[model samples]
Target: MAELYELSMLLGDLEEQLVTCMRCGMCQAVCPLYAETGRETDVARGKIVLLEHLSRELLKEPEAVKQRLENCLLCGSCAAACPSGVKVLDLFLKARAIINGYLGLPPAKKAVFRQIMTRPALFNRLISIASRFQGVFTRPAGEILGASCARFESALLQDRHFMPLARIPWHAKMPETDEPAGPDKTKVAFYPGCLVDKVFPDVAKSSFKALRHHGVKIYMPANQACCGIPALSSGDRKAFMQMVRCNLELFADKDFQYLLTPCATCTATIKEIWPMMGQYFPPEEQEKITALAAKTMDITQFIADKYVLQRKYDDSVDKGGVKVTYHDPCHLKKSLNVHVQPRTLIRVNPAYTFVEMDEADRCCGMGGSFGLQHYDLSKKVGNRKRQNIYQSGAEVVSTACPACMLQLIDLLSQSHAGIRVKHAVQIYAQGLG
Candidate 1:
């Protein structure tokens, strides 16, 4: 009872944003989870109502409210579709921190987020060791996608086709560099978010290849921290801030025109979420964060905006090339409005014919930890995306986010779809050859 009072008090801080939701039901039209379950509690308006009730002490079941909140994908669909222009994602994230502050996090999450993730070196070492022994417990599930499944039935693995960690992480291959820009070239810092570093090192390689092809200088720093979205979404503000501070320190002195990342999620987190959550930091720290966020750009966005010539080409021009479709990650499309840049990158590649997939901007259902906690719901949402990809009749599917690549690969591979998955940068880089 006392804890509930304290939680409500904490939630009181968001009362202004909470009341912004007019319950217009605009969120329903775009919510992927609500579309699957048709449950009121799964939608933004429903969740907002619950938070309001909890804040007012009109609700008694904190556990039930917490469960309903955790069931969300945090894909920003509701916030994007809101006619009221409510800051739905910001309100929900802050409410989550308030609720979890009173309820407390699970032991496992505490150890992982606070202990392992906050320390980049330890986290990298652990993932490296796990990569070496992963072959023992997992077997190849999809040949073309390079996905794996558990050798024996396991609760965690559970017949899911997942991309395995790279044998050698990207940083190990190119630990750090301070390459100078060529004549009339721009210098940019490269950030390979956790997934890109550990699971899809090729994306990092392709990003480098593409940047070099354009005569852009590179300045990759050592010991880059996780973007902290995982920790923040899990309601661990402490861990999230730790990561932000670590990254701020690393890039504080580096001289670069822009900060670029191959991962859409990382780009959004740095450019949007970092500034949104910067209120917790000191004034000087907030200024640094704001500056960094301003300079952060998605790799595809950087290439398309600065280099690619925007001109419409007839589909017949590239008819002989492999047909490729783009999937707009929720973070890239909804949060950052980056839907067009990645497509531009794909369209510029003469070796690939770009096809428009139905609902290309829809969420691929990998909401960071959301998929891990709600695999059944996640798969239900992802199956829809897979169906759209199949209908496109494309030989390859490309996206800007590595996490989306993970989800798309799983969905397409599990259904035995022959379509290959590649990052837009990868497709663009291949064309440079």
Candidate 2:
């Protein structure tokens, strides 16, 4: 049984933050999962109430309470629209830490986060093996989408279709770089995150082209760890802390005006969530986090804001270009409020006609580790996004998150659809030369 005092102390910490929530229920309107299930428990307000109950000692099962809290997308919708200015994501993350402190993460995630992700070398090797053996387990599901499904039933591999790991993750191809700021301009560090470095190396390569085109010097580091969003969301703070420390150490000495990432999750996590959880760090480390958080920027924001995009398009130019639509990742849009710049980058690419997908800002159901904990629900949520993607009638789909890329590819492929996936930078970088 969880002690009253310990739970009480956690409740004490949550007290002020909880009071900010006025129960306005605005979160219900935009929540994708709540829209599908129509379950109050699925919405942010209901989850907040359940958490309040635990704080007051009314809710008994910490496990049950934890389960309800875990059901959320952490998309920041509630926080975004909130009038009373409640930090819902903050509360959820803290509550996760408290609950995990009491009950601990499950064995499998513990292994994955603590063992695999915390160690960069081992994680790379493990993914390398998984990439090699992928065909033995998965079969083609979407030709146009290039998605695949599990060959056999398994807990981890359900009916979801997904992009198989790249044959050579970007790390193996281009381990690292340290180029000086061009004679004309500024320097920036780039953290591609795991998915981009591995599955979506094209995204990284394309981003490099775009950044360099802007005359932004690149400082790509080697032996980088996962951003730890997957681990932290699963309530594994130890692993998450390890990842932050690892990245902090690698980039600490480098003198750069900005640190950037193509992945929305990494941008959001490092900029927002990292400092939110900085209470656990030492005084000096906490300062380092503050500096890092202040400096990190999404690639689109960096490009659109730092430099003027070069455009040489006429209505008739590249009329035969690929048709593409964009999806706004929850982290990129709701978390960091970076909705338009990516699309602007799309607009800059005259080679591809930028088509607007239905509900372009909707979540694609790849909520970090939320998919792992709830695959069926994740796919169901992703289903709406797939319809929106198809309904747009575009031949290609683009998004900023590699996690979303995997999810979209899976859903698009599952329907046996033919939709190519591209990063916004990939589209824009092509027009540079």
Question: Best by TM-score, which number?
Answer: 1
lDDT per residue as tens, model 1, 263-312: 98999999999999887789999999999999999999999999998777
Q: Which ranges in model 1 have alpha carbons more than 4 Å from their true place?
A: 1-10, 56-59, 316-318
What lDDT score is found at residue 190 in candidate 2?
A: 90
Estimate the overall C-alpha local distance difference test score of candidate 2. 0.83
For each candidate in turn, the TM-score is 0.96, 0.93
What number of backbone clashes does candidate 1 have, counting pairs of residues 3 or more apart or in separate chains? Answer: 0
For residues 288-397, could you state the per-residue lDDT of candidate 2 as single tens digits? Answer: 99999999999988887667554543433446678788999888998888977887787776678877888888888878778877888888888889898888888989
Off by over 4 Å in 2: 1-10, 55-59, 309-320
Pick the lDDT winner.
1
User: What is the model-wide C-alpha lDDT for candidate 1?
Assistant: 0.89
Sequence-dependent TM-score of model 2: 0.93
**Clashes by residue pair, model 1:** none
